[model samples]
Target: MAGPLAGIRIIELAGIGPAPFCGMMLADHGAEVIRVERIGGRIQATDPLLRSRRSIAVDMKSPEGVALIRDLAKDADGLIEGFRPGVTERLGLGPDILLGDNPKLVYGRMTGWGQTGPYAQAAGHDINYIALSGALHGIGRKGEKPVPPVNYLGDFGGGGMMLAFGMVSALLAVKNGADGQVIDCAMTDGSALLTAMTWGFRAAGMWKDEAGTNLLDGAAHFYDSYECADGRFIAIGSIEPQFYAQLREALGLTDDPDFDAQMDAGRWPALKEKVASIIASKPRDHWCEKMGHTDICFAPVLSMAEAPEHPHNAARGTFIEVAGTTQPAPAPRYGGTPTDAPTPPPQAGRHSDDLLGRCGYDEEKIADLRKAGVIA
Candidate 1:
């Protein structure tokens, strides 16, 4: 607990995917994030997203467990949940009740379609969410069906990160003497927000609505990934004039008259074919050796196993070992107040007694709750 948010406390009602990711983000920055899990939830030790949390398990089906959450929230600066809109309210632990208990609490609600949209109550995943936001539509190769970018777009980037930002912003507002408020963060909304720059380009006619037809969407010959002789890929992003010149020089295309019209979109298909043929003539390492240090905006495609071991990543300490697993380190370094190394993921209910005791429940009461099967 050594970061800018050192003193902040958050109670996370245990969920999956983005909710845990949000909790990890807050905990990484030194917020005290207590994750409340079900009485016997499985623990995922190697999941980096669950690291740095103090786990307390409770059977929220019982009145005692619901009351425990409310009690915990009374002293918490924020609470994040990823249930459907009315789920928490049904549990009697919704924002209305929590904020009543603690007027300064920031209640963050994470969802897919939003709290009040037509699709709010519908079931969906990252692909569906991004699809609704016009994000997934613009993603894929030309003349191909849209390809999902795993779950990064909707789950992590849009959903979890947006909720984390909203939580911090609301917590700061509470510190400034403002009353607490509920944040309704939806993945659909967040994904659209992430595409703001793209929307601007479209509005200005600088972007085409078709997938893979825009400047930054893999249509340009100078900004795409190419296969090497060894079947590996190298990504190039020499968009700017000077960088394109550098790319031409590095690829020995400077003397090729066909490569002169860098911005001619009509010529991109043929130029891309030419570039692909040249890049495929060499191995990935050959291109890496030739242009890795230049301003060509080039990089060899790396797998998850290779990324952490790369010299640049190792030199920057971009990844770390936790619980005998290699994972990304806490990011956006704070020079003045650095964050501590992450603790290992905890077993469900590992800190149940400890957290309840801090909430003023005596050891006997905690034991009673356990005996009654309210807490585990």
Candidate 2:
């Protein structure tokens, strides 16, 4: 069967980072995502991360180009953009225009701060956004510098994924006859939403404000990564007492007095030191063999290259080889409708003529736009 979102048409204004990632997710789940590139074309070649979308190059500054996108929006289910606020409005492709042309269109806007906040127009990156959301403050060792979480927290997880979800939800609402609305998805807002449980913990006095001083944030000896003798790392998440006991028995750490005071915040540092020393005595593979699939919640910290080859991931088909690159497969599997990898990312303006034709532009008009430099 076709994927769940098959037949849905989405227009994606080409952008870096989260916006493209969100488009990729939509296309992966079977939306026909048409990426609108700038006239000169996208800067990068087709890569695994940007796979599965069609491209149509257009000069949005030109009146004809703006009209072309407006025409496409008239028939599109959604439009996603990552331009700073007012950028799209200046280009004449803002939500008001698109929604005026098609009230059912779901206009999804993504940014680091938000559409209208104190920092909305300020320059920032993942770290800045997550920092303001209280995520970065809780992410590192007590006295060590806060480390960037590889852009996972803000960019992909909070930004792109949240935009995709908002667009989908908005589409659903419009389909049910609700008026189309703009979804302003800020990485800061989404990251804060992601910390809902942590906020609860803080309010209940279960979580402290300090970094690396909480149960799940490397404050517990039983819930952290340990570097083994070979320099490879293994992660442990033995949160429950029973799981902790299993972890202790598996690692022969039951006799250590430090392990006994599992929840004593004052003793965590010492316990962590002892656990680290014990773990460093063996290689990561040894720990994997000891507690691979048990309730101890243990696994070797596999690198990107090693992850695809992992037995569990391989058995579950969680990764796939595409265009000579191993990338994650479409996720959250559907029982009945199987989702497949889409065609490789297209060259810029590759589908300009075809897409224009689909939007009711005659051959003559398409040729005219190309000659006028409105459509590449």
Candidate 3:
């Protein structure tokens, strides 16, 4: 069967980082996303984020190029762009004009800050955005500086994924007789929303304001990563009583008097040191053999190179080879409408002629635009 978004069409203003990630998600699920690249743009065919879409290059600096984008967006179901608040307006392709051309379009705007705020036009990255959201403050070990999670929380999770969700929801609303709308997805706002459960915990007085002192933030003796003899790490989370019993049994720690007080917060530091010493006595493989498939919520920490090779990941087809690049497969599988394998990432302007033809431009017009350096 075709994928769920089989009939959806999107116009994506080509960009780096999270915006491309959002487009990738949409295209992976069968949206016909037409990526509008800048003329003479650099091409990286191995970029997984650029896979599963057709590309057409255009010079946004020219009036003809702006007109071309407006033409292509006239019938698009949605459009996604990542730029400063007024950048699109300066380019003369803002939401007011595009939505005028296609009233049913879902115009998704991605930014580190929302369209209207003091920092709306300020330069920032994933680290700064998460820092402002209080998410960064809660990460890292107790009494240590906050460790940025390599941009995962702010860029992909909070930014791209949030924009994708907003686009889909707005599209659904448009389908249900609602007018098209703009989704101002800010990484700061999205990252803040990601801390919803933590907020609840704080409100309930079950969490600490200090980093790494919370129940799930590596302060608990029963939930943290420990290094083995070979210097590899294994994560353990035996939160419930039954699981903690299983963990103790697996580690032969049931008779240890120190482990008797499982939830004693005052004893956590001492107990954690003891658990670390025991775990350090053996290699990761030994623990895996004893507890991998048990209910102790145990897992060996795997690096990016090791992750795809793991048995569980292989069995689940969590990664796939595309264009000689090994990367994560499209997720949240659909049982009734399975998506096909993704197409390879394209070079800039690879589909220029085809896209122009689809937009009702004849060969003469396409050739003229190409000759004028408006498209490539």
Candidate 4:
């Protein structure tokens, strides 16, 4: 049986990062996603993360190619694109044109700074977007430079995921008789939205303005990583008094009065040092054997390779092997209509003919476009 979003159709204007990620999400959940690639097929071949979509390379600069995309959009339920402001309009495949063809189509635009901001036209990367969103400012250790959390915070987490959510939400609204509208999913805006809880804490006088100086930000001695004797890492999150007491007993730290003040900001550094010294006296394996599966909230810091093989993750089938590479499976397990990974990642324009055919272009039209260099 098809997945829950079986009948949805999405046209993805291929770019990099967020746009492809959004398309992958839609395709994984049973949407028929057609990736409109550039004529030269400007995408890497080994990106496993870009799996689960059909591709059609077209030269959007050509009138015929633009017409072909407009034809595809006529029947598409949604359209996702990640380009600078006015790029799609200039290509003549903007929301106005596509939505004019399909009034119920969800036009989802993914970008770093958004469609209409001072930095919208400025060239920026994931770091720049998250930085401006106040996410980077609250991420690292106090008195140290802000750490870029790779591209996860802005690119995939905020930009692509939010775009997918907006597209799905708009699709639902359209299904319920609402007219489709454009979804401007900005990484900067989404990243800021991701920090809504922190903002609430700040307003409630429970969160400090400084980075790594709050309970969940690694300021509290109870919530941080520690090094073991074998040089491996362990994470601890004994936040509540009961859990802290359990941790103290488990670690033989009952006699340490300094450790008793769980919320003493002035004593955190010393407490952390003491905890580090105790943890380092034992190997990671020893600590795991001692406190694994307890209310102490303890765990060994496993690497990416170790995570898939981890007992908990393995039991839950959180990762799967695809195309000889291990990657995370689609998440948020369903009880009835379960999700499944699609076919392996295709080579650029691998499905050009098939995708064009589905878009209502006959074999002769496809040959004409190919012969005219309008499509690959």
Candidate 3 lDDT over 4-38, as tens digits, reads: 99999999998889899999999989899899999
lDDT of 2: 0.88
Q: Which ten residues in a row are the worst by lDDT in model 4?
A: 41-50
| lDDT for residue 297 in candidate 1, whole number 0-100 | 98
The true-versus-predicted C-alpha distance at residue 244 of model 4, in Å, is: 1.1
Clashes of each: 0, 0, 0, 0
Local error of candidate 2 at residue 45 (angstroms): 3.9
lDDT at position 155, candidate 2: 91
Best by lDDT: 1
What is the overall TM-score of model 2 with all chains considered together? 0.97
When summed lDDT is taken over every stretch of 10 residues in candidate 3, the lowest stretch is 1-10
Ranking by lDDT: 1, 3, 2, 4
In candidate 4, stretches whose alpha carbon ends up further than 4 angstroms from where it belongs are: 42-45
Q: State TM-scores per candidate.
A: 0.99, 0.97, 0.99, 0.97
Q: Once model 2 is optimally superposed onto the true structure by TM-score, how far is the C-alpha of residue 148 displaced, in angstroms?
A: 1.3
Per-residue lDDT of 144 in model 1: 100
Task: Give one digit per residue, the lDDT tens place, for model 1 in 167-222.
Answer: 99998898888999999999999999999999999899899999988899999999
Residue-level lDDT for 163 in candidate 4: 91
